[model samples]
Target: MHGPLKGLFAWRFVVRAEDDVRHPDGRASTSLRQGVRHQDPEPIVANFILDTASPHTKVCPETLIALRYNGDMRPGQSATVIVQGVRTPCVVGRPGEANSIGAPFIVDGSLTFYFDHRLDAPVLYVDDENADLRCRAYR
Candidate 1:
């Protein structure tokens, strides 16, 4: 039951990073880097996917900043996240890249918002563990 979400209010999810990575193709990976070239976590501003059936949410480097999570509301300034008490650095780029701002996706199962028109909506990442937070703006 998915269609154009026009004129409908947008929603957000603020969740903690899980140890699982659900790829766009419905494949689950253990690490986000997928063992390509593991690096430390860094500050980022990226968009995430809002899946109602999904048990988790994800973010890239760009959406993390644009959404103003982890104290990165200003431009030219880096953002960061703390995992296990260790602070790591991160940045946002494009999808499938090491540092993407947002990852495009189609979420079905439990998303509950109204749209007057169809939209490829952007879901910002919040500095939370659970992807259940909400935002008030549309970017």
Candidate 2:
């Protein structure tokens, strides 16, 4: 069987050293935010800082609360995540004391940081638009 493929692109911004500070206990930390959306009748969307080091995606408590109003979401539940037109299955978890994304969806995406004397920016590409791919941005 064959299906339509989709792709999405986004720009990345760097958090300044002053903005990226260490916790009092001595933990390296940085501020990185990205746009995330879910494919639903009333889509759940928010801007979340990307954490490549994190094995599981984390969502903000408030965001989750809002999502609950729209869809049935439990503390330990699974939801479909749409990022840059890519779909990925992710577990739902509250950020608790930490600021996090509402939908902790994970997908196979690429992030490239360009470093040049004149220009410095990072770009994120989610999902490949190859003809052979089976994933679709929309149902």
Candidate 3:
């Protein structure tokens, strides 16, 4: 239920910053709150452009510039973006860590887009066990 997207169109879509984290007291956190380190409502939802040529997924340069990123995108250095969405510690990254102007992934570089031209609807397979978001691109 997550791949083999077949079509003849440029790839692009909106990828959401998952609200998968919970606070110590079991609260959901998102960027739509205040007092969080990177409190802002604009980044929770952003755009993803398919670019198989680049080596790894990266934030849009301008977005990073706007966030004034200073090595915050480094490995093992996550921030507490929205410390409290509804009432917990969640949300991560700056304003541009999710956008991909070029590239697809860094640590998990297993995504590849192929057009078989024989299927319908775009699909995304998040291989959680293997931590892979590998998928075929479509709309």
Report model 3's TM-score to 2 decimal places.
0.33
Give one digit per residue, the lDDT tens place, for model 3 in 29-62.
Answer: 5422234435323333334444456544444433
Model 3, position 11, has a per-residue lDDT of: 36
Q: Estimate each model's TM-score.
A: 0.22, 0.42, 0.33
* CA deviation > 4 Å runs, candidate 2: 1-40, 68-76, 95-107, 110-121, 126-138
Best-fitting candidate, scored by lDDT: 2
Error of 2 at 97 (Å): 5.8
User: What is the lDDT for 125 in model 2?
Assistant: 37
Best by TM-score: 2
Q: For candidate 2, write residues 102-135 as lDDT tens digits.
A: 2233334422333344543334333345511533
lDDT of each: 0.33, 0.38, 0.35
Kindly report which residue pairs in candidate 2 clash with one another: 32-49, 33-49, 34-48, 59-101, 60-101
Clashes of each: 44, 5, 3
True-structure RMSD for candidate 2 = 16.6
